[model samples]
Target chain A: LQALENIQLDLEAVNIKAGKAFLRLKRKFIQMRRPFLERRDLIIRHIPGFWVKAFLNHPKISILINRRDEDIFRYLTNLQVQDLRHISMGYKMKLYFQTNPYFTNMVIVKEFQRNRSGRLVSHSTPIRWHRGQEPQARRHRNQDTNHSFFIWFSNHSLPEADRIAEIIKNDLWVNPLRYYMMGEGVVRSWASERQTLERPSCFRFWIQ
Target chain B: LQALENIQLDLEAVNIKAGKAFLRLKRKFIQMRRPFLERRDLIIRHIPGFWVKAFLNHPKISILINRRDEDIFRYLTNLQVQDLRHISMGYKMKLYFQTNPYFTNMVIVKEFQRNRSGRLVSHSTPIRWHRGQEPQARRHRNQDTNHSFFIWFSNHSLPEADRIAEIIKNDLWVNPLRYYMMGEGVVRSWASERQTLERPSCFRFWIQ
Candidate 1:
């Protein structure tokens, strides 16, 4: 029994080492991918309604946007997710908006981080909603199941907000082009589209 | 509009480059982690009923296991998943078993790989059942929702098989200890247990 416990300890030690190595590799890749992400952002900005359409095309994110949210999304100029040095530590999301009647703020930022105690905590900038212009208050009846996307800005320490951030970081931020094409009705079949986009000739080189 | 197309093309080119680099990084890390995985296998082998308990503890995997399957799992000596050079190309799963009354084969191997046409294909070693001892033939009516785990050995070109392979590769193979602990009733609160197991001091070094 004592020997068994020692074996378990050895396994745990190995797992910790593997996890650390994985994080390091991930961090290195994130740094290498930064310039490409920046270039993508620059090109995507010139395309009108790119970010809004991409958001609408996402199944999980789309359900959260109401008609009023769509109106606000039209003014969205840029969407950026910062890994905050390392993805395991936390992430920050920035949504840039043009001068709009709904809010006085030009950019809304939401951040998730671990405190000193190692508990996950989150906070976001308050949306300076213009009087009688708050999207949350003017709920669309047909979109009863949906919550106003603006409400996401004020959501702190909620699982729903965490889920949305994950989708944005893992899905939308990684390959917005897929969603953008979906929104444009260009992708009639998902499987074929995915094959064309994801499986490049370069992949064959990795096989050995 | 023509210029927009050019920009989109440029973005796709960048995405392809990023994807290639990511795969290279992933392959490198997988190679580095091989020795640790082998060491883990050595330690885990001496622990009786470890793999069976781990399988029973997994929610998605548990649902597919019947009582008769449990009997067979008792003889399970080793479970291994080979990435087949690179994860993107495909993976192979090997289940090593001790000689038991139910079957003559000592090892069962299932492989998923891309064909010349880039279509995914799969094949597995046929289970040679001892006369009148096939678990699939003897269905337990009470376990209507569950399929015999042995049925997984024969499944080919199925999305369900693909999903199970993904779970085994990504979830089970990566951190079987979590499930093993859960099976032992040592982990009551998942969130707290996850924090204790996953968050090591080495993680702090990667933050900067």
Candidate 2:
């Protein structure tokens, strides 16, 4: 009887131990809590920068990089970009990456146009697309080269636009890659029809 | 004797089952493997996109978004970014992010000036910045307006540059927030720079 009692106690003890271990592991990796290091310190600190640069630039250690790859550390795997209807761990991480500021800004810009009826506001006419909600014609032509320059500049500079673009199918987001892909199409649709890309000396920022 | 034998068998079975469960849990969450559902589908999938957009764009839901917060989800935590001489989960994730394409390209651009000796090759003359260890002077002025425009544009479009700038105090990365903070100092540095904030016609892509 005493031997049987000892065996029973040992089994119960192990069961309890395993249960505790399982909970601890789940909390450590599965919870939506803050990470150990903060963003500013990670990005601004010299030591961290050194490691990132070395990991990225080292020919031997950073072998994951491809010659033609645009963004070196870009996280656009096919699995990562798929339709995420179901609730899986994959969905959880995606939720974190998608709503990030870069992607959201792209969405806002895409929505800057259409009204409640989703009508395309003509360039020549002044319309209160939002704000006061008044039907007024556009006072200034949106074709200013400066605006185009800014757009082009933003597109070329930030890979975020492309990542955000991958998240949406329709014209509901400002996709820099798609815009650049438009090529001459962009040159044709000038709201105010301000200036052209002529004059070789016209400060071509795109030529590298 | 029968009871003791039965008890022994039950303990063995329970031990095996617990062992199996522990392995399953580790493989499911602990290992650094790619999640299912491709990247494009994950972001572009209507269901996932809807959730993300609702979570991010909804003022009440995505209150975390500030200006240019896309990279906030980006996991360059300080400990991860630090010396990286140490091995860790943060190190592993950072390794994945840095060796990715976007980051490497940025590094190439950052190293555009260094010669074989990692010395600064001045921008006034024709120089082989990229070489088989040959030293040369730069063909054009790095301070050209076009260069300034490209740098300025990059700084505003993505926060990566600023984060990188923090990693290195020098001019390798163009940090917009820091530049903006310079304010009057920047204006003082540029005399021939022209500006026409005409008619409130500015198309700010940032304001949501």
Candidate 3:
């Protein structure tokens, strides 16, 4: 009878230990959930109204994401004529955005390259293109280049740049192969036009 | 007395609205804080003991928390020899990580260019040093050229090459202000490793 009682006591001890372990796990889980939920809400709240509406109107029963929603934003902005040609595939986009500082300017550029044999092969060497928000009159006169792909959003402050960068960082979901970030003060000078590749020449590393 | 009572009631209504607004803001604050705290904790937990011991030994009481801790992990792992230059810099660091199958290599290369005025400028361009990590090593030993700087990183994939191209996108960063990302496919077709001012004929868009 005493042995039976002792066995019951041991079982109760084991149950209590298990309960404690479960509670600890519960606390950690709660801690983990808190941040994830908050970020989810933040993302949902900050999506542009136009994007939301456009997505709703899509025939596929959801939103359609254009190139503007892609990972190429920060890299594509503030390009120059010299920088546009390296983009081998789509050299013909005609739309252009001028830096607010220089109303006469009408383009932006980003450069990309690929290795061929032992040599570096670039289509345009330094790819250049027109920013997408120019008036129709300006665009037609600049007919030498195709301007089909440029998209424009209002330029925000550095903090906004940081937020956009964060979104890019978090949603690097499609291609987990490369990650990129702009270096501190690696942007165009304050006096420079936004649509020109007049960024300061300095050594800045891009995260890959 | 009735009018005075109505005024007090209006004040109570205003207070209630204010309280509701405050509550909403408080909820948002908590929401944002939840993810930040949890993410921070997750980061803290993953740090290895060696770093903890190192940091504890040399705590900078006045240091600002500017960079993410994951940057250290990037510096340690997936690090190619090209990163050694920046790691030599004692400034605060930023890091980005990737695990793409195509990201097989990293290398460092120097580019030399002459500006419009014909002034020679030398700059180091970090190439995605992959299978052909150092073309300059072979070229420097075999060929004799008066190029200002002689180094280059070579890689197999264009996307991987872009990872380095993105780092040195600024023209002002390096003078004659030019750089290149040479793919192995392109370099293999080059007629000669030694090309120069007298031999513009050797210059080809796709060098192999």
Best DockQ among the predictions, by candidate number:
1
List, for all models, the DockQ compared with the true complex: 0.08, 0.01, 0.02
Q: Could you arrange the candidates by lDDT from highest to lowest?
A: 1, 3, 2
- Score every model by TM-score: 0.55, 0.16, 0.18
Query: Which regions in candidate 3 have their CA more than 4 angstroms from the true location?
Result: A1-38, A41-208, B1-208
**Which whole-number lDDT from 0 to 100 does residue A114 have in model 2?**
22
Residue A124, model 1: Cα distance from true site in angstroms: 8.0
In model 2, the runs with Cα more than 4 Å from the true position are A1-9, A25-35, A38-55, A58-61, A70-208, B1-208
List model 1 lDDT by residue over B109-136, tens digit each. 9887765434457888999999877664
Off by over 4 Å in 1: A1-25, A32-50, A53-67, A88-93, A99-140, A143-208, B1-18, B33-50, B53-69, B88-93, B99-208
Fnat across every predicted model, in order: 0.03, 0.01, 0.00
Instruction: Evaluate residue A179 in candidate 2 and report its C-alpha lDDT on the 0 to 100 scale.
Output: 26
Model 2 residue A115 CA deviation (Å) reads: 48
Q: Counting only residues 3 or more apart in sequence or on different chains, how many pairs clash (N, Cα, C under 3 Å) in candidate 3? A: 57
Q: What is the lDDT of residue A129 in candidate 3?
A: 26
Ten contiguous residues minimizing lDDT sum, candidate 1 chain A: A199-208
Task: Kindly list the per-residue Cα lDDT of model 2 for residues B105-153, writing each as its tens digit.
Answer: 2122221122232122212112222242111122143222232211321
Residue-level lDDT of model 1, residues A37-101, one tens digit each, is 67777878889999898899888789888777898899999998876654446678899999988
